[model samples]
Target: IVGLPESLHAEPLETTTVRLPRWVGGSYCWAGAYIAGELMRAEGFTDVRYVEADRSVDQSEWIARGETDFSVNFPPNQIASIDAGVPIKVLTGLHSGCLELIAKESIRSVTDLRGKRVGVDGFNNSRHMWLTLMSAYVGLDPVNDIQWVLTKDVKPTELFIQGKIDAFLGTPPQPQELRAKKIGHT
Candidate 1:
């Protein structure tokens, strides 16, 4: 990392707008962003406003467009955006161990995912990216080995429960819900 010029230190801007997620799947990552924005606002350093982008806009796109000052997301997703010429830098590591690849009892492992229908919220979202990486790691071509089930019309949980999908990449509330209802095994 290149060091900033010594003259860069100065009073922070007095007014700013922050962006964060309104959904639960990545909310754990949002905790830090929320506190930092709130603390800045509370300390009178800035008049902060938080905008929650709808599902139509992915967080990486928001970062690329400078619509959001900070957000937490998967590394692969961020790297892909950067490779596409998005101006983003990894400041530091926040946390990990939040994502889980959940599957039904019949699907025992990543290899079992081959020929199975996997549900994801969107076609190229982090979930989809991670699933593809995993599939490739297990010697399966993501496009041909697995049936990609886009869950744009319905949530993955509902589709999984209805037997429309055999496995999915899940986080937080959905995983908790699946466990509570005895729906699937991680």
Candidate 2:
């Protein structure tokens, strides 16, 4: 069922295990992928496994290299993979606009991000790309103006909390943690 988007609902396929990748621990971007794995196991479709899993910037590439069966990726990465002939397709849009830009109180708006340290999971990652677009919209030079700090799997929000960075984009758990501690303003 190539590119059918019915893998979850279709009849069970014979396989030892199906591998799925999570960007990070229960992050909003990859939550659907994780849930799908759990659902597949619950439905007896296949034994779900996670592989090549890390906070690196190339989950799409992992899929292209046959390291995993599927992944949850943002549009820019997916499109770039497809352009590189990765032989992958968008199964569905899980969710969008879930990432929240959490910044210190001194920072007011996207425009104010100029010359400030903005933490991201990785360069050109979903968080970075979205923030870059936001910077462009506010007439800031995305590349030259903002200082992007890469924390990868280390959690940029943690660094932000420690005052090592000025701003950062947080997904599910990160944002929740920030809110619970009343750390930063969104």
Q: Please, what is the whole-model Cα lDDT of each candidate in the order they appear?
A: 0.78, 0.78
C-alpha-based local distance difference test score of model 2? 0.78
For residues 67-96, write the lDDT of model 1, one tens digit per residue: 677666678777787888878886765436
Question: What would the TM-score be for candidate 1 when compared with the true structure?
Answer: 0.76
Error of 2 at 62 (Å): 2.4
Model 1 worst lDDT window (10 residues)? 5-14
Report the number of the highest-TM-score candidate: 1
Off by over 4 Å in 1: 1-28, 38-44, 53-55, 93-95
> Measured by TM-score, how close is model 2 to the native structure?
0.68
Q: Work out candidate 1's RMSD over C-alphas.
A: 5.8
The collision pairs in model 1 are none
For candidate 1, give the lDDT of residue 14: 49
Over 58-87, each residue of candidate 2 has an lDDT whose tens digit, in order, gives: 677787778888877777678767887888
Q: Which ten contiguous residues of candidate 2 have the minimum total lDDT?
A: 22-31
